[model samples]
Target: MRIALGLSYSGSSYEGWQSQLSGNTVQDQLEKALGKFANLPIRTLCAGRTDAGVHALMQVVHFDTDLQRELPSWVRGTNAFLPRDIAVQWAREVPAQFHCRGSAISRRYAYVLLESPVRPSAETGRVGWVYRPLDGAAMREAATHLIGEHDFSSFRAAQCQAKTPVKTISRIDLSQRAGTGSSYWRFEFEANAFLHHMIRNIMGCLVAIGQGQQQPGWLAEVRDARRRDAAAPTFSPDGLYFLGPVYEDLYGLPTRTAAYDWLP
Candidate 1:
């Protein structure tokens, strides 16, 4: 039987989402825990791979099991065996043909910015700290140009191993959250797919525009340029969150104009 499992993990200790040769990985830990439960070799295919230090609020993964274990027990059992940082939130029987990664119609990633002179206590895992005053309005304007299908080579990481650089950024919603001292900003983006480090790279360019280092109109020209050098530096991964994967069948998922938030 095939099962779809909802997982959430803190990527602090792991090398990345994939298994590694020399370091701890989220996949390695998951496989070991699942193998223990199955008493047989087990593996999972995740909806997405987050880099080290990244966090996923809701990541879907699927695995096949010949042992017809109860679906609810898989969630309870997996959580019991897994570390606190890695958890199995929910599990259900899925069609054998339902693939967690390939079947995903869209992916959403949110990058947070804590624009403040002083560090914020409430935003350790949630927001990236920036000491400089960021122009929130400018950032919003700059991000508008990125909301379309384009060859995103200008913002892709040089180390990115994807076969192609083209991606359709369906939406890029930039806004500020209400706060007292530190201004909290969010960049919520939805795309059919994303290349490695794509969201952070776009955040970097947006930051540059906010800081007046780059002009707002440069984003469109950079897309047209299709050169990696055309974009600014990559933003820190600490402020980014893989909010959730958008399956076509889930109606609760936010649409283009919906206010984005962390999802389970």
Candidate 2:
């Protein structure tokens, strides 16, 4: 049977979500823990692959396992074997055809920026920090120009492997908040899917706007440019988080409670 697992992790200690040969990865630890808990080989296919130093609040992964374990036990047992950095909040039996990645209708990402003059504290490794004061209102205005479908090549990573540069951005919002006594900014985006480093690149452009390097109308021009070099530099990965995937229909869980609840 197919099983779905909700995951959350701190990206500070690993090389990204995908299992790699060069260094430790979140997928490596997860597969290992699931293997130990199930007493058999198990492989997971995730909703999306996050880059190195990027966090995920509600990443989803599916695996086929024949073990007859209770749903709650699967959650607890798998988490027991996993390290402190990664947690499995819930698990549920899923239909064989329900794929974690392919079935996702949309994905939401949140990028954080510590934009005050003061540097962020040590506790902010996974969050982004900028040394200059940012204009949040200007950033928000710039973000509005990016909404809707467009060829986002200007904001795409040069090394992106996706064959197409076109993508539909459902929404983009830039908001400010009072951080742990400092000013901060949050950049949020929802899309059908994303290209490699897309969020980071968007964040970079927005930061440039906040810093007065780019005008609010520049985003529209970048979208029309359809060239990677036309945009600002790719921002740091520290601020990126894979918030969660949105499914249009129920994924065949036993109960609504069984749906991924790791999101906050």
Candidate 3:
């Protein structure tokens, strides 16, 4: 049987989503838990792989298994061996043709940022910080240049293995809320697919523009340059969250988790 699972994790404790020799990645821990639960090794394919210190609201993974078990049992059992930061939120049996990564229609990610003179203390690893106040209008204008299909090579990471740098960004939504002494900003991105560190690279430029380091039109110039050096430095992975993938209605998978609302 083919089974799919929805997972959420705080990536601060792991290297990233993919398995590594150190066995310190989220994938390694998850597979170990799964292996312990099933009494056999089970491999999983995820919709997307995040970097170290990145978080996930809902990460979808699928694996083939011969053992028959109730969907709820899979969740409870697998989670029983998983770490406190990683969890299987839900599970379902999927058709053999359903692929966690290939079948995804679009992927979503969100970056939560805290803007204040004082760095984030309580939420240090949970959010990205900017000491200067950000200009919301300038940032929004700069973000408009990123919407629609375009070559995102300027924002693509050097280590990215994506076949093509051209990707379609369906939406870029920016919202802010006032906190006690500072303000919180949430940047949501929806794209057909993302190159490694794409969003973080773009965030660097956006933050630079919002802080008056660059003009809004500079973003257009950077996009047109199609060179990684033309963009700003890659931002922190702490605030980055893999919001999961958008799949067809036939799959019957949950897109959002309760943590989605808790962000920002």
Q: Which candidate is the best by lDDT?
A: 3
- The digit string of per-residue lDDT tens for model 1 on 118-200 reads 88575576577777778878877888887888899988887888888988889988778756776788788899989888988
Residue pairs in candidate 1 whose N, alpha carbon or C atoms collide under 3 angstroms: none
Model 2 clash pairs?
none
* Residue pairs with backbone overlap in model 3: none
RMSD (Å) per prediction: 3.3, 2.8, 0.7
Candidate 1 regions with alpha-carbon error over 4 angstroms: 120-122, 250-264
Please write out the lDDT profile of model 2 over residues 42-130, one tens digit for every residue: 99999989988998887889998778989999889999999898898778788888988888888988887876667667747767888
Which tens-of-lDDT digit does each residue in 165-231 have in candidate 3?
Answer: 9999999999999877789999999999999999999999999999999999899999999999999
Supply every candidate's count of residue pairs whose N, Cα or C atoms clash at under 3 angstroms.
Answer: 0, 0, 0
Candidate 2: 10-residue stretch with minimal lDDT: 255-264
> Would you list the C-alpha lDDT of every candidate in the order shown?
0.79, 0.83, 0.95
TM-score, one value per model: 0.91, 0.92, 0.99
Task: Choose 2 or 3, whichever is better by lDDT.
Answer: 3
